[model samples]
Target: MKRIGIMVVAAFIGGAAAIGGYKLLEPKGGDALSFQEQQNVLFASNPKVASTGAVDFVEAAASVSPAVVHIKTSYTGNSSNQRGGSPFDMFEDFFGGGGRGMQRAPRAASGSGVILTPDGYIVTNNHVVDKADKIEVILSDRRKVSAKVIGKDPNTDLALIKVEATNLPVVKMGNSDNVQIGEWVLAVGFPLDLQTTVTAGIISAKARSIGILGRSQQQPTEEEYEEYQRTGKMPTNNSIESYIQTDAAINPGNSGGALVNANGELIGINAAIASQTGTNVGYGFAIPVNLAKKILDDFRKYGAVKRGYIGVTFAALDADEAEKLKIDDITGLYVTDVVPGSGAEAAGLRKGDIIKKVGGATIYDSPDLQEKIGRMSPGDKVQLTYLRDGQLKNTNVTLKGENSVASTLKPAVAKNTNKATIDKLGASFAPASAQLKTRYRVQNGVVVTGIEQGKLFDSWEIPKGVLITSINGKPVNSSKDVEDALPATRNGMTRISGVGPEGAFTFNIN
Candidate 1:
């Protein structure tokens, strides 16, 4: 059903492109075939050709069709099934909560992937196997095999996994940077459980963010949310503008699928879309093939995508903002804030520096800068030209991501406001695991696994991937211990602290 819905969307988005392909490619170079040749070609091309005739999509679709596949993943562990209730309660029971209780269950998950190499290298979304114990790929030929994780980048939501196989079908990638909006592209995938589904659309727009991050204060319009839909159909202005936006419909099962050009060359990975009603809204986003290649390189070399940072926050100035800033005829990223310790910081780059270009590519907005930098790893060096105090200046900055103290500032989303609720942090917590004892690694205090909407910790300022080192001045034994220690301070404020990428922070709650 999910796959089917995705397929329907692809058809709708591809409606015009498919029709266009039919009409434009239907005839061979406009050269009229001889009477006998016409009859032979007509019948041989399509079994049921309309009076107008039919375009042979076989060469286009078949050229890259077999390279697509489906992916399924499963995890091995009791935690998969355990509803991580209060660890304190579990502790009370575990010693003897009556050992006759329910046992933990196994966890299994599924997704899709595409073959990148004939040797069995498959690419898919990183979320598909971030923590899976076993990953399985089912090829177009219906052969299934276990795949090994090659590399993954969460920032880009892409993962590359490898299966030991021979003579595999591979999809050739095209230059996404060269693709233009309104260009024709096809989305090939197994949508809604349908095998080898194909849809079409034109690039609508490009480089759009869904505001999943709280960077911009402006609310995302329907068009703004199009990047996350993956319907393969969307509006203009939402795509990267660098995308080969098409009207072709895309859907859920179409994720990680192929978006190819007229030459049937893979250009982008069909990703998201825009829709208020959860269907195709004619808006979709795809990772540019060139950018994907860069991200893939990082994943293969570092096991994850590493984004280079310039430390300075930026925005492409519109005419209004440019006028307000007393600048004339400018289309470049306006610097907002230069992170104190980031790459931009060490280079003496200050806030409000208008970046004209990075490594020679014109940067018109933050997204452009992001895409450019994101395609690189920390410690990578690059040259930049910017306007500082109305003077055109040039400089270089080296990116860095492996922050030693980065684990100290991650936010923790929890219901407890008590500074001593370390025990409540339940879930996965790394860094500390290796730095601390094996017992302490698993016991790094708390890593809130799940949150209840109405729970007390729900109101607390908790962020994901946060590490609770210690609450108050005591050691944490279990979750309930923190709940019990939480001070009643809804009207009053309480102190809560944790660690993450930026270091450590302590704030008061209301």
Candidate 2:
């Protein structure tokens, strides 16, 4: 019985070894032994195995760690699902190989932020702090500080946050507009709680749109409402039509981070990625600095983007449309209409005019031209280049900045129609020509830019644009004359004197 048992054990052991051997030698759809084959995975999985390249990734990671930062944010409501999307959280598990609505509770989210200004103006994706209740910015140096929201533009999905500090290292703004496909670039941010993590790639394309922010959306909805709730102010959305496309392996926490050139200049603000499986598939987009500059200026001056308006809309021009329009070439923005009496109309610009440039910059399409014009304020004159009958004409047009260019911000002061006093007069005026000035250009008056659209100014014996030479017979040349001419109309209707678009004309008011 002992001999029989020993024989059975030896046979079992032999079968076990044979099965293991078969697994080791199993063919992975190939007849030859190859390093990359599945049969060789056991060896490949071992740490002692070498990489495909001569370089070491460990050294690169160590070098990038110091520059990365972790960002942690706490917000109201249930936010458990997003708890891991932050840069800090990202970098925390980044070495281990790691939004909503899908277990996806609204979890507190943490991610990375990049220190752009040494004095502590960190830039990160607007989504990271969109509705944060408490935002805590931690530096790669392990210092934590409370960050205040400075300005955020959602159309581009970038936000600028300020922390108290000085002598800080500010990343030089790079020209994302200048980046082209396949050009070397770098990505710096906190991913998975890891700090100063650096990744490298190349410019994959230009003006790439991934639709992550949605069309015509400037500020994220949640962020805008928060701004309103905190300060009783509303933010303006600046449409982002220009973006720098890169292949820098941008992941979730990479939003609002920096896309720098080899010179370490910030060319673009990393914005979005394209993935069928919810991760980077080698496609990403960033807002160009040119557009970001305007957003920043709007934030500084008006609390929101004071977008310039032309008051006319049109469809994008395709090659077929260009041919139908008899365009000489395809390198110009076709003007479909001139906003009646707006800046474009006042400059003799017509519906058929092809806008070739704004200021000194050549514009081949509406997106580029609109973005440039949108950045200007009213009263800021810009030169326009257009083609009229194969003849290029350059004309200068003054913009309107207030209602059109003033801040889009809601007035904090109550709308008090009740001023100290009420002064009503039946008079109107507008800018006078040099000849009219010769008669008298010293009146503090502005041309009746508006006549209540078909009221006293319309029925006036004078015509529209008829330089309101005077108001109530008061010597009127500029806007001041009309104001001075305003008579206390407590009694009956009043008559005013003015010049018509052709010659001297009269108008009446009450």
Candidate 3:
């Protein structure tokens, strides 16, 4: 009996020492495990119940709803003071309508967000907190905390925010590339000012671009409006809209919510709704998690998205477009023009090339290419498969920064030298005739004799027979004078002062 007791005591001591050693060497709870792994371990016993049917969303909804947060924002003035073009007419649903003009009393608005990290990293739509003065987030446990915007990308309509808290529930990020049509998904959010709501639907489509960012994006000041009025074009819109379409009943206040799979994995971020009445009409859109992952990571690393550009203006081709362009193929994007020093130009892409594939994925429309390129940054190499004169060819192009491309296109022309800079203007010029100068009452300038499509001058819509007085605030009697007067940049803007058919006008090209 004594020997047995001593053996039992020795065994207990060894067991205690083993446990203490593990406690010292094991990964610390917060730093060792990622948010997903932590959650997995926490719910190991109550594992995600796989859906047996397409409509079984009970497990998914329960898991996702806890991570979908309610975000309330306060704006100092009216929210609807600025407006432009929108391919999707769902802005009224995402942001409540208000009158334009003067500043109004402070107002409150609400939206949804998905917690991405236990330390309070959240993802939401940029429009939700675009101009908000203060933001408050309500968690599943009904606890309220203030959040600060970490970064915002108006181009993609996505924003990252964080709160001063820990142990927050997080939704696991899933592979959006594997999301299939007709697969059941859940839209979880706080919609129509209600509590956490979950609606089930199937994936309706993929790679949908609706052009909604222009409507809710920030507008330029009055001086900047001169370029828009002169050019008759919306200011350079770099908005990327490769959304995953769904039938999920996302309504007002659903912006920035979670669109999760039946397994409760986040596949997309609930963004827009297509409804004529500002309510659900069986059409909704979500930013694919595949794209959001890159964007959110960019937001975390840099304060803004480090977007890369292919530097080619293109139009998606259909049977009608192919027939119009006299092409045999009915699919692919028709490359209209390549930027002077862009990756497309460096890769030998010309005016009539057809872009069929990016990397290895086939390109059916703008979104397919835009979203893929949107995921990359400057200096990234992308393989392109295209057709030159009906012969398929491939090339690897190294993307360049926006500033590098802009600088490559010299914005001015000097005398008799190659005419390269003049060509860059996309317009032919002639010395202003004396009679023409007398009629227009301008001193010395050049006439816009001809304009080319898809060129800077054409984009400005400068008509033929227009007389110019000066460029960059210097008198220009010839192309050489215009060139000498132009500076590389004035605060990174090219200023053009000229008299057109409309009247004497001055505008800045940004």
lDDT of 2: 0.54
Best by TM-score: 3
Candidate 3 residue runs with Cα over 4 Å from true position: 1-54, 78-90, 93-106, 214-235, 408-510
Candidate 2 lDDT by residue in tens digits, 243-320: 677777876666666676665556676666665444666766667766766666455444565555653333346687
lDDT of 1 by residue, 237-332 (tens): 111223334568765566677888766667777655555444455766667777777766555556666655555545579898888877774688
Of candidates 3 and 2, the better by TM-score: 3
The residue-by-residue lDDT of candidate 3 on 368-427, one tens digit each, is 998898888899999999999769999998988766654543232111233334655676
TM-score, structure 2 vs. true: 0.56
Q: TM-score per candidate, in order? A: 0.58, 0.56, 0.70
Superposed model 1: Cα runs more than 4 Å off: 1-57, 74-109, 213-245, 319-330, 404-510
Which candidate has the top score in lDDT? 3
Ranking by TM-score: 3, 1, 2
Instruction: Kindly give the stretch of ten consecutive residues in candidate 1 with the minimal lDDT sum.
Output: 232-241
Would you list the clashing residue pairs of candidate 3?
none
Instruction: Flag the better candidate by lDDT, 1 or 3.
Output: 3
Better of 1 and 2 by lDDT: 1
